[model samples]
Target: MSALAAARAARAAGRVALTVPQLLAARAAKQPEHVAVTQGSGTLDLAAWQRRTQAVAAGLRAAGIRPGDRVALVYGARDWIAYAAAYTGVLAAGAVAVPLSTRNAAAELDFMLRHSGAAAVLHGPDGVVPAVPIPLVWDPAVVAALPDAEPLPGPGPADPAQILYTSGTTGRPKGVTAVHANLTHGCRLDPPLRRLAHSRQFLHAFPIGTNAGQTMLLNALDAHAGMLATARFAAAHFARLIATHQVGSVFVVPAMAIELLHSGALAEHDTSCVRLFGSTAAALPPAIAAGLAAALPQATIVNYYTSTEAAPTQTSMVFHPDRPGALGKATGGGELRILAVDGTPCPPDTVGEVWLRAAGAARSYHDDPDATRQVFRDGWTRMGDVGRLDADGYLYLADRESDVIKSGADKVSTVAVEAALHEHPDIADAAVLGLPDPVLGSVPAAVLVAARPLTLAEMRAFLTSRLAAHEQPSRLAHVTALPRNAGGKVVKHQLRALFDRPDQEGTP
Candidate 1:
């Protein structure tokens, strides 16, 4: 059957068939030759992607994989096209896809493989192979040579589809599993609300296997424009893609934005095509957001707030000069609520725990019932963020609950402290953490990447108008740059070790 007919049959299969393969078929039917995904020098069109994934699915099953069996995919952003094929192939084969990043260490890779009990590991192109024993460990590139088997039995809305592990910002990562229903919720072929429709391409450099990267992969299969990615994220390459492709939208984390501004790439490149700039993974600090606005004068700055556990359901804020502090409000059938310690909704603008509920089946930690129970209740997931909603329902985050620091009698939000630091004339990036204090038990510490060495007295004076007396950093350390992981979050544990060393101590 032709791609169109396959899509029609897929639609006929269920009232609202939300399977990934069905979505792929549907897109091919709509625009077969459109560039679906683009990386450094690689590109895949919709028609070719559908055809390749079908063969790939057959090849995996021929290799002895089974329905509902777990298959780990270890591909990076550089291998996006191949990764896309392998990822969709696993889903088409009716097996759950457990995607791992090549950026992960061998030890980390082995842990996820053993934890998920992955039946096979598809290390396509240049994916990292864990040391664990597996029945099959093969490159998915071999799928191109295989004759297609009978079409997969097809998936249902409730069929287990994907397993994505959390970014280990705080501790060891956990496997977050979801069904097709959860993955495809709110995804429509003809989305009533269209964004960046006038542009032919959109760009990003989010790593594969990350929630952000996975979202872009889905965008390639479903969005109006082709998805553009690069092997590595450099301010110069990112701006060049926007100019070369006349890309209409861009997505990034705050770290990239800071680097883009610091590197002055936006000023050097002709990136006049972008109309929307969206930041996710973490909130964009206000200072950085303003820098982007000045640099991309025509683009509307948008901030996306979501987590691996709370995806699809998120708040997307269109930056308004009036609400610089506001992150976003819930959109797309997503419900956001801030609850006090007593489990009641906190009044608007009152700080409390954040809970998010997306529109479909809830996700759970694979084989981790206790961990699942901790975050997923009824249908809502705890965001583990301390934040508040304004009268207009805009979210303003204070800090991660785990990062809050107590100084003497007051609880200081490290995020708030860091925000103040970002506004300082000399500081380019900052991370606020808690360190031991003789009197306060714990006090705020500042790790800085400043233009010049700054004494503790200067920092305190600069923060006087912006931060509370107790919120200011009690211990300060200067570093050429803050250590960040691939996803762009400061490695806090590593940052803390600096305080123990006497040499890089706060300036006397």
Candidate 2:
């Protein structure tokens, strides 16, 4: 059947008929020769990618994998095309794909394998598979040689498609179960190939298995652009790739953005081809945003706000000189609400819990009913962020509820303190956490990575004008780097350990 005919049939059958595998098939049918993915010196075309995935699906079926069975994918970003093919193949075989990070230690990997009850493990050449016994283990070469054929009884849109574990910054990571519909929510079947396309190449360095990485993978199939990714992110390497590929659109985290701004790599490359630059994972500080705008004058800098469990219903803001700190209003039929603790709607500029109800967001955690109920209620998901809406409905983030530091009679936002620190010329990166205080219960303390030697007195004087007395850091420590997770968020809990030692406290 033709791609258009299948799409029409699927629409008639309702939403359950459309899935990720079907989307890939549609794109491959329309643009068979288009470059689908580029990594370093390698490239994979659309038709060949589709064919390889089909072969992988056949191999999984021959290995006795069945619908709803979990298959863990272990690979790095450098082998992205092969990983994409494997991910698609798992869906095509009607099995759930669980993508594990290559950075995970043996214990972490073992826990995930046991937690998800994964039936088989598929990995790249260098991937580290856990020692836990599994029925099947297939390397890239093994699956690559399978005969090309579509597997029977593929997954429907309503079927559980993937299991993504959250970054366990606060506690043990929980698995987020996403249906095929959630995965393919915004996919475009007949995406424009000419003038309407955003760019010839979309560049990002998000590792495999992350929500951002998965979103980029879908864009590769549906956004009418080839994807360019790196195994690991280094500011200079990222800038060089953009110039080499003439990449038109790029996505990054705020940490990556800060690195690029300070590394002087932008001056070393011809980055004039970039037209769209986006930041996600966390709010981009206004200082970094302004620097990015100045460096890439032709690009539109966008800040996206969304959580792993509340994806597809995102809030985005295109940088405007007037609203430098706003995260913008909802776009593309998304919904947002700021509500008080009592569930009342907050008035304009009132800080409250941010709730979102995006179409096709994840329904629940994989097997944790208690965790699911805590965040998901009455069709709305609490974003775990404290924010306020402007009179015009633009959202301004204060901080994550878990990160707010209670200092004496006042509650201080770590984000606010960090923003103030970022404004200082010598400070490159900053993280604020609550340290135990005898008088104030918990006081706001800061750790900073500075370009030059900085003293606590200088920091206090610089922040005095910008922050209230209670909001200023009480204790300051100078460090070369701040501890960050795989997703680029500072691990505040890890920083707490620094204060536990008596010798590490106070100004350096």
RMSD of each: 2.0, 2.0
- The TM-score between candidate 2 and the true structure equals 0.96
Error of 2 at 340 (Å): 1.7
Query: TM-score of each candidate?
Result: 0.96, 0.96
lDDT of each: 0.84, 0.84
Off by over 4 Å in 1: 1-14, 148-150, 190-195
Question: Candidate 1 has which clashing residue pairs, if any?
Answer: none
Q: What ranges in model 2 sit over 4 Å off? A: 1-6, 12-17, 192-196, 501-508
Q: Give the alpha carbon lDDT tens digit for every residue of 415-459 in model 2.
A: 888888888878889999988888889888998888987766777
lDDT of 1 by residue, 169-279 (tens): 899988999898788877765566544574888889999878888888887877788888887889898898888899998999888888888788998999788898999
Q: Which 10-residue span in candidate 2 carries the lowest summed lDDT?
A: 188-197
